[model samples]
Target chain A: MIASTSIHIERTTTPKAKPPQDKLGFGIYFTDHMFIMNYTADEGWHQSRIVPYQPITLDPAAKVFHYGQTVFEGLKAYKTADGRVQVFRPDANMRRMNLSNDRMSMPEIPTDLVLDAIKGLTHIDQDWIPDGEGNSLYIRPFIIATEALLGVQPSQAYTFMIIMSPVGAYYPEGINPVKIFVESHYVRAMIGGVGEAKTAGNYAAGLKAQDAAKEQGYTQVLWLDGAEHKYIEEVGSMNVFFKIDGTVYTPSLNGSILDGITRNSVIQLLRHWQVPVVERQLSIEEIYEAGKNGKLEEAFGTGTAAVISPVGELNWLGVKLVINGGATGGLSEKLYNNLTGIQYGKLEDEFNWMVEVK
Target chain B: MIASTSIHIERTTTPKAKPPQDKLGFGIYFTDHMFIMNYTADEGWHQSRIVPYQPITLDPAAKVFHYGQTVFEGLKAYKTADGRVQVFRPDANMRRMNLSNDRMSMPEIPTDLVLDAIKGLTHIDQDWIPDGEGNSLYIRPFIIATEALLGVQPSQAYTFMIIMSPVGAYYPEGINPVKIFVESHYVRAMIGGVGEAKTAGNYAAGLKAQDAAKEQGYTQVLWLDGAEHKYIEEVGSMNVFFKIDGTVYTPSLNGSILDGITRNSVIQLLRHWQVPVVERQLSIEEIYEAGKNGKLEEAFGTGTAAVISPVGELNWLGVKLVINGGATGGLSEKLYNNLTGIQYGKLEDEFNWMVEVK
Candidate 1:
């Protein structure tokens, strides 16, 4: 692994002014500089550099273009009060990135090297981090197979890159409830697939269903297990949780669900609050039954993008099951506030999850 | 749809010397020219042109690099004895490409536009078509989301390109038999997924299992059904077929197996020769039983790369089931000869599957 001191930097000569904070929607605007490292069989990962954010040139036959041999991670850099910048749970994202590499038949990336790259790039673009409420610098680290070959094998060349985007809150209208379509058709993934990994293919396979749900006025599709099509797997790209009868339930890690960092944090926070939380298989039928009997109290999704998104209603095969009367639940709001507060450095982080950038 | 007459051509000033026919491997050497087109939400598909083969420049945040929003199709251009260039079933590939576009939420290429692009590009680089036995120019057409966005949604801009590569025979040792490992651990795809579409993710998901099988001294892996793991799905990237008691059997298209164009042609040829062919779910146990009872006459895989790859042995859970004593079967030879003969213009074109490039 290359030391952090050896990272070569070439500052951009033409730096443009940052976009207006109010108009900084998701990933439209990129920072001035980006981090890149190349990997090859002859010379492992080498030539770590930070250069001007620019277009990448590749042979049309690269494996990443034809075979989808790619993986990515998303996290954010928060500008706290008093001009401090911090990143939340970056180690977890790096660990999960290695897991994705293994499942995609790619080489493992050293955790230290990844952390160093993130830190170096984030520090260089520290001024890009937004200080507004719910706004942060979204960082995307992705790896793509660059081997110019057209075969069904693992690539011999790879490129790991990190780019930053200044963004606004996920819910610009405040933390409101979102309507979800319980998808009975079109499975995202099955056992022994790359569903558990943050690979490109799993997301590509979900575009059709997600678009269909959007056409029907739903925010996201609630995915079911590919094998049985009965057990709940995830809500869109986020891990889901249900609060019923004063107990919290989330799907267990069944080899098909992603190990979400935010989901883990929520579980830990719930346990600390003495809330009854269980990780087990919770089927859609059971959730519907609970809703019919007035026992289902709340439902929410957990992910880095949206810390906690409350589910107001679920349309399962044309049957709408309203949760918490199409309003955000009390627990959901509390969890969201606490998580955001800790992230923005407004509240005490008892779990030591935040890592401040120097 | 624009007519074929509107495709503008730009010739390369420095033409590349063609590689030796004997050394041309699959997807390694490309022709001098290629076809490209662009698509956007406002203008749809526009700027159809044949330009010199070169690297494509894309923004670092292109959707294809992160979310794998891409689809591809493969076909071949053959050089006939009469000095005419013909493509085998180009229409089928275009239809399948549209199906893939639908599944991946990309805009469809009109069949006429696709055909025109293929014909125009093939005519421009007709000299690249190798003349050796079993040698042909492999054609690859793919579409990638080019919008510079870092979200999971489908892109608003796309690029469709067609590149040609001269390839030798799939098996340099001729049409010999191969040993396959029955994979029950890693699933290539599942029901209601992108298995039926020729998308990149399905191929990426099979690399780990394919590499593992290769490490165990196997040529390829035979994928089983994702749910029960009882029924056979496919062999490597090809559609599999089995012959028992003089009847040919292939797995039915159960939403998990790709609709291979070569597989369709073989079925048609079998029925034309009065050979009884059945499309049903064939379990691995049933095949093992047939092999043990000396009733398994032949097994083969059909795809564009390898027209007919005979499977001589199947190592299922360490139990070797050898068919025809590890030698190519009579039926396998006949089918291969007939298919190749028709492809190369050596035999009568009874089915009229070839389209000449004028």
Candidate 2:
């Protein structure tokens, strides 16, 4: 087995030209190299290497293809004003990845090794970090069951890999609020399922509802609890927060919502600033009622992709609730500016969330 | 794009040596040839072909690897005493596959095309049908989102393939009863989730509980409803049936339980035999009460892998309930014999469920 300190590197002979800074959309273009590690029942994780970005081959009956035995984490490497590279709370993402591994019945990668691979790969492909505004190199670390078997069990073999892609801002037209559809027919996850894990199946379960919402001219779908479809769960791919009657509220970690690193950071910042943030179950009906009484002040979603996605309008059962007159709220804009400023090394790192790449 | 009637074949240059019939276990040995088809947004499903069974190359960023956009079906092709190859209720499995595709936000294939591929592949690999007791050629038809993207949306490209494996009986000791663990912690799925669909995530979520059950000396874990955790859902990967007093009871299709073909067939056969049967919500507490009152007569699971797995003992919350004195019930044995008889062409298939492969 390859140890954490003995990672091998194979540089690519030919490197492709990077795409234009403005053209770097989300997850479209990739860097020249990637980090990989293999795992077998007998040998554990071995052959840790950094090689050119390439295709992977597996037997037709590999478990990941048929059983969805996979998990992944997404973060970004930011280019600071001082020409230095840094990643935001990579350790937290790695720790959460381990939690996901535990929930998905997969072997957890050592934290040190995961950090080494991420830092090493980001340093090597540092040039891929776009210089344009709101552009950074998105890092995706994932693990998949590679055992060539056709059974419903934990795989005997696995592969862990990290890939990099330069991504532009989630919204090209500044931090504008997006229209959301309240989904009632489809559910993303339940309490006892793999909803809390960063596994593939949770994302797949949301696609149908997302597609339907898009057809209805909504930017995203606001999911509700799986059992009663009453309490709010999440919005799109992020943790949501609602401001009503001068207090901020986000859904508590009820074992169905993802414990997002950004969500945690947002909560910490809100508490530090004495913004009266509370984590509890907030139902959609209550939000609508607040909207009717003119108490629904602000709503936004927090995640690595968008950082802070403001909510413009919510349509539930044909009853539209326009918050802040379909405009971004003051708290949403403030959170976005503060979070992005800290990520880009402009704001003070009061919580020490930033980690320099090299 | 290739149509249903336009499937091409490429014979292998060198065929593989078939494994010994006695040594053939489930999903371990593969046939020489397999069927494959591809799908893209612009071309729909195309390039339908039967080629040598081999490894598939995919980009690391394929949607299946990251987002679990995959679905699969399991059925068996039997070689009867008359030397004819046949498959049971294949159309039902194909229809179920399409339902899974719809739930996962993927385009469904034509039923005619899927039937053609299964029949064509079975005809070509007839020699691989093992000549052992309860042995058959297991067919695995799967679809995966092959689009090389890293976002949580429906993939624009997909690959559908059918592979075969030779297998023996599910239980080496014959149709003997097995112990089951009543799970209370982890739920496989809930209402409004992808529980009814034969998608990858549903199977992935059950592995952890399955592992724990195995460690506790149980053959399978009896999953309960995700919301209330009271109503019985399924047993391992199969639909469960219980006999209390005199009537046969199986959980209804409540959107959380899979619509098992075997379960449906058993229900039909029972009704034809003038045996009372009911489909409704069966709770664990009620089952325990029946066990205490000696009214619980029989219990078994139904699925493609194990036609009927008799439940000998159930360990729930540290209370062990031994059913039928740790032996297979008369009804369980009868169902197994009748089902296997119909499958092997020994008894009359009154429902005309068997499809003869030509």
Candidate 3:
């Protein structure tokens, strides 16, 4: 593991002008500086630096281009009301990224050192953190295999990088409800696959289904399990939850769904509010039945990008299951408010999830 | 669709010396020039050019590095005995790559134009083709999403490139048998997944399982179905076939296995030779039962890299099922010879599979 003190910094000689506040869409504009580190079999990890944000030059035969040997983590840095900047649960992301690395057969990174680098980079480009409501600096940490070999085995060299983008809210509507389409055709990930890992292929595999959902006038696709299309797994890139009969239910880890940071935080928040929250195999048919019996109260998705996206309707097999009368539920609103409050330093730090950067 | 006449050529001025024939390994050394074509929604696929081989420069937020919205194809150019270069089934690879683009929600490329580009590139770099019993020029055609956006959608911009490498035999011990490990715990791709697509993530998902198999002293992994883990899917990156009771059998294309070009060629050769061939669901238990009854005579894998790799032993759940006394079977050898002969222009072009480059 490399130490944070060993990281070298090189400021940009020509920094581009920042985009307008309204133009800060998700992942559209980047900061002036980016963090990078290299890993090789002989030297382990070295050459950690903060260089000018620029294009990555790689051999055409790099494994990352052909083998998809990569993993990524997404989090956000929020600006407090008093002009302080903080990141929410950076350690949790680092830990989960390591698990993803193990699943993807890549080397595990030094989480603490990477965390310090993240903070240092954020602090250096602290002005890029958007200040308006429902806005934050989206941070992306990723690792790619750089070995120029065509063999299917893991690459001998790797590159880890952190790139920050100032973005507005994930949904321009802001906490409103969106319709979801239950996808029974295209599969995302399998039980013994890289679904739990935040890798590239899982996202690529879902594009066709998402495109179909969009064609059907839905905001996202609610994915069923790959093995059996009966069980619910996730909604787009987010973990899903349903409130039924005054109790909340979410799909368990189950070796497929991602162990999302916002999902965990929402579950803890539900438990703290004395609300019953269960992690089990929640089927799409069961949710449909609950809606028919008027027991399905609310539904929402949890992810780093959106934070919380309320599900107003689920269209499965040409049948619509409307939840909370197509509006954001009370509990969903409260959870979003609380989570975002803690993230932006508006609420008290009960879980100590915020890491402040001076 | 762009035509071959629109292609602009830029030769490399700094041509490097080629590697020695003994050092000619798979995907190691590259030619001086490469084919590149860009795709955008407004422009379609324009700006086709052959330029100097160089590193690909991409923004850190390119979707290829993050979401794996990419596909690739592999084929080989062989220097024939008559001093002419030829390719085997480039059309099939191009068609399959188009299907992969459809599955990944990418814009469909003009296969005819791309085929012309491949031939033109091969023609220009014909000298790099190594002339030996088991040596040729390996060509890799790949497409990467070049849009520098973090959103998980189909990229608006893409780059299609063809890079060539002179290679030696896949196995130093030519036409030999390898030990295979049946993987039950790790699933490759589900029926409704992107299993049939020659995409980057599919290869990434198999690295861990391959590593585990290698740790157990196996050369490759025999993948099982994701739904039930009962039916055979693929052997490593190749398609598998078994000769049992004087009949050839292969797992059917059940939407979960690659439509291998060599597998097609092998089946055609068997049919032309008046041999029985069947493509249906094959169970591991059936293979084991056949092995026990001394009915499993020969087994082999087919792919572009190895052409034909005979399987001498299969280890399934602590049970070793050895085939043909742990030696290469007669049928496996005949098929390999026939395939290589046709590919190298030694055998008669009965099937019209060879495409000669001027």
Candidate 4:
């Protein structure tokens, strides 16, 4: 294992001007420097470096471009009231990235080396973190197969990189409820497929469904199981939750569903607050039945980008089921406030979720 | 639509040393020049050019590297006995590529320009075509999302490129039979998924299963359907066919299986010869029963790489089902010989499938 002190740093000579906090959209602009590491069959994982942000050059026959052999992670770094930088659950992201690698048949990266790289790079580019409310430095760490071969087997070489972008809030208009379209025709993933992995192809498979939902005046898509098209799987790439009978319920990790960090945290927080939260197979028909019987109270999605995205309505097979009168429920509002408060260091770190950079 | 005459040409100043024909493996060494074209929302696939083959530069946040918004097609150019170059069914490949693009939410490419690009590039790099038996120049045309954004949407910019490589015979030890492992765990594609498209993710999803089969002393894996592990979908990324009771049977054009050009050609050739061929759902149990009942005659796979791969043994759930006494069947040999004879210009082009390059 390589120590963090062995990391080589090459600062950029020409630094570009930083974008304004208000103008900083989600992932439009990048910082001056980025992190990169290389992996080979003979050398394992070595040659870690923080270099200038530039375009990467690769052969046209690289396996990643032809086979989609890649994995990624997303997390954010926030500036606390004491002017210190802290990231929320980066270790979990690293662990999940390795899980994705194992699923995609790529090499595993050391968690310590990745954590140090993220913190070190975040420290160097601390000024790029936005200071506004619901704003942070969105960090994207990904790995791609770099071998210049077209065979279907695993690649012999790989490249790991991390790029950061400071962005405004996901809901710029504030935490308003979104209308979700429960998709049944298009299957996002199969039970025995690569849907559980945070791989590129899983995202590509959902672009058509999301685009269709957008055209139908829906903000996001709620995917169903490939076999039955009954069980709830995910909501727009995020883990979804439904409140029925004053209890929160989300889909279990059924090999086809991603084990989201925010989803896990929300369950823990709900259990801490003595609110019933269950992780099991919850079908769409049951949810709609509860919605008709006045048992469904609220619905929301959880992810890194949007800490808590409240779902105001769901349209399933031409039937619209409005929740909480198309308004954010009290529990949803409290969970959003508590999670973001802890993330931004506005609340006490009761669970020790925030890890300081220094 | 852009005209084929608008494509600009730039020759390579530094020529690469060509490898020997015996060392020409699949997709390893590329030719000197490549064809490239750009696509944007406003331009709509403009600026076609043939330039020197080199490394391509892309931002770290390019959509292709993150979301896997890419599609590709494969075809081959052969040197006939009369010293002329020709491609086998390139128009079919182009149409399939457009279908893949539509499924991936990418922009469509003009078939006329793409055909021109293939012929034009093959003509320029005609010297790279190997003269050995069963050796040809493999052409890979792919398009990738080039927009450097972290959003999970269809990219606004795309890069389409065609790269050529000389390849030897897929079966180096002649047309010997292979053993296949029937995969019942991993799923390649769902009915409503991107299985029919020649996209990258579907290939990646099969890597783990293929590796496992290799460890178990199998040449390739025969994938089952995603919903139920009963119906046969494909064999090692190729379309499979079974000869039982003097009639050829292949799986129907299910949405979860690729529409192989070679598979279609083989069917057409069989029909032309007045041979019995049927396209329907053929299950593994039915195949096993046929083998036990002394009815299974021959089995083979068809694809661009391997025109026909004869399957002599199938390991299904630890039960070895040997066909034709674990030897190449007469029907398999005839199909392969006829296909190669037509591809190499040794037979009459009755179907006009060969498109010659001047």
**TM-score on alpha carbons, each prediction:** 0.98, 0.98, 0.98, 0.99
| Model 1 segments more than 4 A misplaced | A1-5, B1-5
Docking class of 4: high
Proportion of native contacts present in model 3: 0.91
lDDT of 1 at A90: 94
lDDT of 2 by residue, A1-358 (tens): 3335467999989998999877777898999999999988888888899999999999999999888889999999999999989999999999999899999999878788888899999999999998867989999999999998887889999999999999998877799999999999888888888889999999999998898999999999999998889999999999999999989999999999999999999999999989899999889999999999999999999999999999999999899999999999999999999999999999998999888988
Against the correct fold, how does model 3 do in TM-score?
0.98
| Candidate 1 residue-wise lDDT, B27-80, digit = tens | 988899989998888878888899999999999999998888899999999999
- In model 4, the runs with Cα more than 4 Å from the true position are A1-5, B1-5
Could you list the iRMS of every candidate?
0.7, 0.8, 0.7, 0.6
Ranking by lDDT: 3, 4, 1, 2
lDDT-better candidate, 1 vs 2: 1
In CAPRI terms, model 1 is classed as high
Query: Which pairs clash in model 1?
Result: none
lDDT of 4 by residue, A221-334 (tens): 999999989999999989999999989999999999999999988998999999999999999999999999999999999999999999999999999999999999889889
Candidate 2: lDDT of B65? 89
